[model samples]
Target chain A: MTDVAVIGFAQAPNVRRTDGTTNGVEMLVPVFQQVLGQTGLAKEQVGFWCSGSSDYLAGRAFSFVSAVDAIGAFPPVMESHVEMDGAWALYEAWVKILTGEASTALAYGFGKSSAGLLRRVLALQLDPYVVAPLWPDSVSIAALQARLGIEAGRWTEEQMAQVAVRSRSAAAGNPAAQLSGTVDVAELLSRPYIADPLRAHDCAPITDGAAAVVLAAGDVAREHCARPAWITGFEHRIDSGSLGARDLLAAPSAAAAGRAAGAGTVDTAELHSPFTHQEILLRGELGLGEQVTVNPSGGPLSGNPMFAAGLARIGSAAAEIMAGRAGRALGHATSGPALQQNLVCVMEAR
Target chain B: MTAPLSAPLEISFDYTRSLGPVLAKFMTALADRRILGSRGSDGRVHVPPAEFDPVSFAPPAELIEVGPEGTVLTWSWTDHPVDGQPLDRPFAWALIRLDGADTGMLHAVDGGSAGQMRTGMRVRPRWAAQTSGQITDIECFEPATQPARQSAAEPAAAAAGQAVAAGQAVAGQVADGAADGAEPVTMIITPVRLGYQHTASTEESRYLRALQDGKIIGQRCPACQKVYVPPRGACPTDGVPTTTDVELPDHGIVTTFCVVNVPFQGQRVATPYVAASILLDGADIAFQHLILGCAPDEVRMGMRVRAVWRPPEDWGTTSENIDHFEPTGEPDAPYESYAHHL
Candidate 1:
């Protein structure tokens, strides 16, 4: 079987909003070119394409279909889509390569989360019969989880503020981050709650952006980029969708996926935690050692572009290896209410 | 203009769903002014019952009665509420571990302020004036001592089944109106509404701007050099933004088309009208538009047509500027002229 590696990756600048259409053509086109340029490959060489996005976020149906314009999809391309974060889309691309269906593949995810009331739109992901009818917004839902963690002594409001401070300080170096600046944890704690126990800094800013990654199997991967980040292990898992039934403080799904993917011994981790407390919870669930440097790209709290943010974490992790910043790294993504779903990708410089 | 054109867009839909057996039992209990929880594989009961045990991956072993009272495991204060929430005013959203259930259920706590709500606070259901099988059956939770309106739960003890059906009353599936079933929460209508500030791309904005001024403009892609009307954000073949504006004649050939017989929501055109893909003389791609002033059968591939503009006063930054297309009476272009587009 051919071993697939992420040969190149690129992301658009995360911003509160873009003047472009929800189809994400403006954001995705440049990133596609950037990734292709990094690999010294042309768009025509991309054999399989997949994407992740939500029609609810775009305020339009089949929004990803229009996004293919950025791929230069003439003569038609074998493509697929997931109504999930882009990291899941990358899994599909990797499968295409490993199965010998394609030698080169590209996976991308994009969203104009700013196009709609993001918290309200997210309600659609809940159980259609019970919870969604109540329309409990996403922030309040996260706050509920955050409070659970805080009350249970698993994490605290002060510590959650520290996560924001560190993420912002780390993000100052990432030009693509939407929010980045050094702040005293004291100042963050002093801020009033946007949703009780969750401050403005604790929740990721709603952003509009896109990202794309290029993958190649074996020799083709070596031909494009010099130090490819090989996929040592990749796995994903989901918890039951019952928000009331699952333990709010525990991300059993993340832990399960981490254990399955052999998520040990990575020096750097790019986690997709939209809420600050979630970062703390994920650190424990994924069992990252205290010494492990997490979210050096500042993670989603600094700049979360919804559908694209998860895939960007994977790209950010691969970049650490490709840039020789780390010998091994892990990328994690989440979906649904309160980290109900999770995917983990572990990569290493081989 | 430095800023692209943008407008408020509102999209809405109603989704109807049927409840499975496990949820049906739960809803029936709610209607009877009682709460039901399912015992999971772990032998713990879950309120707002789990249809299947998460740990066991099997249907719950049994159902049990749970709470009208519970303790707040954790809660968050919402200072300002959005539409459709359990409460419009300030409230605390809490995970309440109802009495007799091991797992917690989520609902709003109608506390006066944040200072009043705390973890481990005891609360009780503020029953609605009218009971419904829906989650809203227990309006919202309030501090245990306060009674939430008089219990309208037992509207008529004599009419047990009728009262239960009334508890299930909702828009699409009016309880009394449903096909007879003692415990079928078979229909749920979810109304989804979203608002957006929809913006046109720089290339598309230019095309639309020209359309407003009564002209047809297109852009040529620098890489592929294809002339595209309602110019694309990226050239579909090269993935490069289209550059170089080109003006084009409205008269063009219909490369392909379909005669509409089915009617859908928001469709203005009459049935049997032709929806055609017009390939303009200077453009390489086809744009969808409608054909009128000719029978649907009269519309054909390779036929020449011209835009029949709405009265000039009716024009704006909209494709509606062209009311429809009409036969131009000019000779149909050779099929080769548009075979590439088709």
Candidate 2:
């Protein structure tokens, strides 16, 4: 199999809202230019293009198609899209390289989450027949999981608050982050609950952003990047969709993806955990010990741009290795309620 | 450097779903104020019954009557409820384990306050005054201490108890209306509505603003040099924004057209009108617009046409400023002039 590596990555600033359209053309254009410029690759040189976004987020059908305009996709280009997070699109790009169908690929994900009442719109992701009819907002569903862990003695509110404090402090270094700076855990605890057991600091802010990553196989990667983050393992797994049937405290899917992707020995890790408790929960499930540096970019709790945040996790983790700060790193992404679906990518400097 | 144009956008639709045998039976039972669970191959029952056994991936073997009362396994309080939730006031969303079921079901509990909610609190269904074949038939769960609402199915409670003891499938029995030759629910309709602030791209915004002044503006792509009317976020071929603005005359030739005899909802024009692709002079792309002031058959390819604007006083930032196009009373251009546009 051909070895694929991440050669370049770029992202838009995470903001509460963007004046641009939901199609993401405005947000995506600059990131595409930046990523391509970093790799010194021209638009026509990219062999395959894939993206992740949701029409439901845009409140318009076929929204992703209009995003191609940002690519200056003139003439025609090989392209595909997934109604999932951009991390999944990266997974597809990796497969395209491995199959020898393309020597280089560009994967992107974007969302204008502020276009709608994000939590209410997210209810549509639930079981359409039964649960969605009741319209349980996303925050309430996540709080249900947080409380389960709390009552089970698996994690506490203070511990969850500590995760928030650490994430915001880490994000102070990330210029693209929407929320950053020092915060007191005690102060966070004193805040009123948006959903009982969940303070505002516990949840990820609704953000509008876009991200792009360039991947190349073998010689093409070496030609562009002096120190490429070579992908050692890539895998994803999903659990039961029936929320009531599964054990919410245990994310079997994350564990499975972690084990398959050889995540145990990474020196650095980036996790897409939208809520504070989830970061703690994922830390246990992925079996990352205290030595593993986590969320150097502050993770999703700082600024989660829906579909784009997951891809940005992979980008951030790969940067640690590409920058020679880490010998190996792991990037994890999640979808569905209570971490029902998960993807893990382990990269190494070679 | 001004922001793009934006407006409120609401999308709504009713999705009618057909429930298979298992859910059909389940929903039918809800109409009678009874809760049902599906018995999995593992012998564990799933509330709001699973369409298929989780372990075996086979259709459920049977549906069993669970409980009108249960214990909250976990919960979170919603201080201010959003639209479409089961309750309007402050309520706790809980995972409840009904009596005789191994798994939990998600629903709301009207516990009155966060202080009243706990991990193991007992609760019972607060049935809707008018039962429908839907999950909302049980308005929400409340403290079991509250008196259960009396229903017409009171006489069958003893029989239901006997069936539970024997672990028998009671969907056919408890859904009494079905036993008396009434139809089981075969379908359900769920209405979904979402609102968003729809925004137009900067380039498109410029074109729309120009239209309000009765001007047709096009932009020349820096890379391809193709002139695009109404502009574009990026020139599709060059992957770059069209920078140089070009003003075009309203008069253009119809590259192609279709006579719209069929009528659609919300259509402003009557049937048999011409909808043509107008390729304005000095522009590379064609835009769709109505061609009128002539018979349907008289509307031909390469026909010369000019914009028919609505009164200047009525103009806004909208394409509707152009009421329609009419014949320019000039000779039609040769087919060669628009062959490439088609």
Candidate 3:
């Protein structure tokens, strides 16, 4: 396999809403410029382009295609899109580089979660015939998972509250985060439950944002940056979709992906845990010990921009290595209800 | 910058599905107020029966009546309800393991309060006031008011192809899910509705603003120098926003077109009209518009045409301000001039 390293990463400001259109061109234009500028690579020199986004978020079909306008794709560049999160798109770009198709590639994702009732819209991802018709909102589903773990003695309500407290406090340093401030665990615990077992603080804010990452193979990666987060392993896995079939407290998919990706003890970890308890479950599943620093970038609970948040996790992890913050880092992304799908990328400074 | 023009947009569709034999049997049984599940190869009965056995990877051979009464495995209370849920009032959503079934199915439980809901509480399917053989036939599960007792025919009844279960709430239950032997619920229709606030990009908004003034405006790409009417947010070739707005005449030549002989939903024009891409005078790109005032057969590529505007009073920030396009009676432009657009 080619030695592909993340050469640059950039993201738009995470916020509850943006005045931009759903196609994401406005959110993407600035980030594209920022990522290219960070790598000191010209747009014409990049070889391949891929993106992740969803039509459901846009409420229009082929919305991602219109996002290409941000790239000014005239003379048509080689491009592809996935309805999945941008982390999966990054996987596509990584494969493109490994296959020797492109020396340098760019991957991006964006979502205007503010365009629709986010939690309500997400219900569409469930089983249409059996599950979706009931119209179980996303928060309610997560609440179900949280209650299961709590009842199973896997985690506690206080521990879940602590996760939120830590995330918001940590997010104080991240300008791209949507929710950040000093918060007390007890104060969060006292808050009324939005969905029985879950509180407002326990849920990631609905954010509209975009993120981009640039990758290069071997020598180009080395020449462009003094430090590159070299990709050691990238793996993704998925479990059964039925909500009743699998154990909710255990994210078998994340555990399997983490094991396959060699997500060993790392100095830093950027996990995509939209719910507070999910962070605890993921930490146990991925085998990240207490010594490992988690969500210094505040993670998704601080600011989750749907399809873009997962990709930003990878980029944020790479940024840590690029900035000489850690020797090795792990970035994890999840999709579907109760973490049914997961992708793990382990990176090291070189 | 001023906020881009925005409007509420609602997209809806009715997704039609055809259930296979296994689900067909399961759904058809539900209409008859019975609960059926597929007995997996491992001897575990699955509720909302799996079409194929997860372990064996084969179609389930046995269909069993699990329970109308069951225990709540896990539940979360919904204090505030959203649209389309089984219950509009406050309720608990639970996973219920029905009698004689090893696996559980998710359904709403009308427990009324958080204190009343628990992991081990007993519940029973509250048959809908009316059932149509859909999963919603069980409107929701309700806490069982009667004592929980084991049914008699539970074990051998399923293997015997009996639709009745033992020690369950079902009494005098009809076994005929498909008495006429008609194809079991082969089709189901689900209506999907979503709402969004659609925002026009800044450049598109600018073009729309121009349309309100009864003028045609195009923008020039700083790098490629191509003119785009209804200017795009960024130039396709240059990766830059078009900044220099240029005004052009409404008259142009049709680069290409198609005669719409077939009709579709929400089409305003009658059949046999031409929808053409018009290359506005001095603009490098063409935009779609209707061609009228002539027979559809006469609408040809490279033909000269001009916009026919609606009365000025009716004009707004919309391209609909132009009713259609009509021929200028001038000879067609040379095909070479607009060939690149095609």
For every model shown, what is its TM-score relative to the native structure? Answer: 0.94, 0.95, 0.94
- Superposed Cα deviation of residue A154, candidate 3 (Å): 1.5
Please list all clashing residue pairs in model 3, or write none if there are none: B150-B167, B151-B166, B151-B167, B152-B167
Q: Interface root-mean-square deviation for each candidate?
A: 3.0, 3.2, 3.9
User: Model 1: runs farther than 4 Å from truth?
Assistant: B150-184
The residue-by-residue lDDT of candidate 3 on B101-198, one tens digit each, is: 88768888888799888899999977665455677777778889744333223222221111222111111223334625433565566667778999
Off by over 4 Å in 3: B146-183
B181: Cα error in model 1, Å: 12
Model 3 global lDDT (CA atoms, 0 to 1): 0.87
Per residue, candidate 3 scores C-alpha lDDT tens digits across A1-350 of 79999999999999999988999988998899999999999898899999999999999989998899889887789999999999999999999999998999999999999999998899899987778867788888898899989999988999998999899989999999999998888888889988889989989999999999999999999999889999999999998888887888899999999999888768899999999999999999999998999998999999999899999999999999999998899989999987999999999996
lDDT winner between 2 and 3, please give it. 2
Rank order by DockQ, top first?
Answer: 1, 2, 3
Candidate 2: tens digits of C-alpha lDDT, residues A1-350 = 79999989899999999998898988988999999999999988899999999999999999999899888775789899999999999999999989889999999999999999999998899998778878899999999999999989999999999999999999999989999999998899999999989999999999999999899999999999989999999999999998999999999999999999999989999999999999989999999999999999999989999899999999999888888898999989899888989999999999
Number of the candidate with higher DockQ, 1 or 3: 1
Between candidates 1 and 2, the TM-score winner: 2
Model 3 RMSD, rounded to 1 decimal: 6.1
User: lDDT winner among the candidates?
Assistant: 2
lDDT scores of the candidates, listed in order: 0.85, 0.88, 0.87
